[model samples]
Target: MTTTPAVRILAIGGSTRPQSSSELALNVAAMAAQAAGAEVISITGRALMFPIYDTETTHRDPLALDFVEKVRTAHGILIASPGYHGGISGMMKNALDYIEDLREHDPSYLDGRSVGCISVAYGWQATVSTLHQLRQVVHALRGWPTPLGGTVNASVTKFDADGSCQDTGAAEQLAIIGRQVVEFAQMRQASTDATAPSANSGS
Candidate 1:
């Protein structure tokens, strides 16, 4: 009997400030992914600190390399970005640019991976626009965007330092995003395994 390996779901993004609401939101989503039985990898705070992406240069800082490797092997992804100027924060966007490194991988740039996107901002406009931009980026990466994306309005909602979300609706929505990513990843993995050749098959 062969048991499938646990799905790896990489969660990335958050504001540069430590323990910001955006980061807390990301944590909530990751927790849900864990509860759903996927192993979660987080790239937040200083872990997301890297030099600007340069397509002309092959040289990459250690942080950039690490981010690329995680994305390369992840079965699913969750990204929670702080909304800046009605779009994603520069820090988060820079980290996302590193995904170009996966273009040479066997599956190529997030292909067949499910991505859950979240946007935390002070206003509805920023949150909604940021979420829209994130979904567009997921499509561009060849990843499937979960049916439900989380748009958290910080003006009306708050995440406590103790990792508790003040808004029940927001918390539930974020969890749904996480669960959906895991579910999609599981389905895709099962499909791939079913089509794989048996070890005992003769050439």
Candidate 2:
């Protein structure tokens, strides 16, 4: 008998502020992933605040260790970034840099995983710029970015305390991003299974 493992998704991003707009957006996307039948683990906001990543050593704070472990185990990822000066936020960048710790792992830094990118910024330019930068970073890490990335313009679109989006269209876009991550993850898993040697082969 063969049992398929549950898909585990790691949702990362947000600013230092608790319940920041980016974090709220992350939660919205994560809920969408849940609705897609994937189990989601969120590491956002203050939890993402880690010491600058140092390539010189492997020592990490407990939270940083937990963060890296989650990244190591996740089959998919959702990232919601708050644009900082037209690029990724310092804290979030530091958090991502920790993925380097998985350089020697079997998957080797998001290899064969799908990443859904979302950017929340006060303006359109920063939002789009951050989204592009984020996708580039994911590619550099060997992860596939989902086809539909989300850009939430904070000026026009608002997220409430309960993770509700003021704009219906934006909400649906975030949902699509979330679903795309799971969809791609399933595809990758299927491809891997198809290519693997069967149990009865060579018997």
Candidate 3:
């Protein structure tokens, strides 16, 4: 019997401060994706530090290049952001900007991938707004946003340093997103496989 490769998931987000609530939430979602049988690669916290995206510069930073490569190869993605003043944090936005490097890739910027979005904020307003923004960005990138995006109010749902969630309800939402991403990617892959001409068919 032949074995199929595990789905690759690129998990990115989190604040500059290590182990922040946003990162913890991302971890929860990533873990859930893993449980759903995906291989997750996470780029968070300080690892996300990159120069502000400059469309004029042809030169790419080494770290940014590696990030782009990961994005290029990922079959699915999870993006979590901390809502800052009713928007995504500058750092997180900057990292996302790096996706521009993938414009010429076969599928282009996040195209045909399932993206799971999570937004963490101190209040419902920021959480909802940030989640909406994430979905919009994903759409612009040509990625499909999972139906169940997570909106985590940092003031209400707290996380332990070990990446455990205090609120069961919020935790379930995060897990659901992760699972949805993997499931959608699998379905997309199946569809593609079905549509492709069979190797045995004449050219």
Each candidate's TM vs. the true structure? Answer: 0.98, 0.94, 0.96
Each candidate: how many clashes?
0, 0, 0
- Candidate order by TM-score, decreasing, is 1, 3, 2
* Candidate 3 residue pairs in clash (backbone atoms < 3 Å): none
Instruction: Give lDDT tens digits, candidate 1, residues 37-107.
Output: 99999989778979999999999999899889999989999999999999999988888888988888889
Q: lDDT: which is higher, 1 or 2?
A: 1
The digit string of per-residue lDDT tens for model 2 on 1-203 reads 78766688999988887668988888888999999989999998888888899888877899999999999989899999999999999998888899999999998998999999999999999999999999999999999999999899988988887779878999999999999999888787888889999988985
Off by over 4 Å in 1: none
Q: Supply the TM-score for candidate 3.
A: 0.96
**Residue 199's lDDT in candidate 1:** 78
Give me the displacement of residue 55 in model 2, in angstroms.
1.5
For 1-203, candidate 3 gives per-residue lDDT tens digits of: 54567899999999977668999999999999999999999999888889899999889889899999999999999999999999989988888889988898899999999999999999999999999999999998999999999999989998987789979999999999999999998887788878989777986
Candidate 2 overall Cα lDDT vs. reference? Answer: 0.91
**Scored by CA lDDT, what does every candidate get?**
0.92, 0.91, 0.93
Question: Following a full C-alpha superposition, what root-mean-square deviation does model 3 have from the true structure?
Answer: 1.2
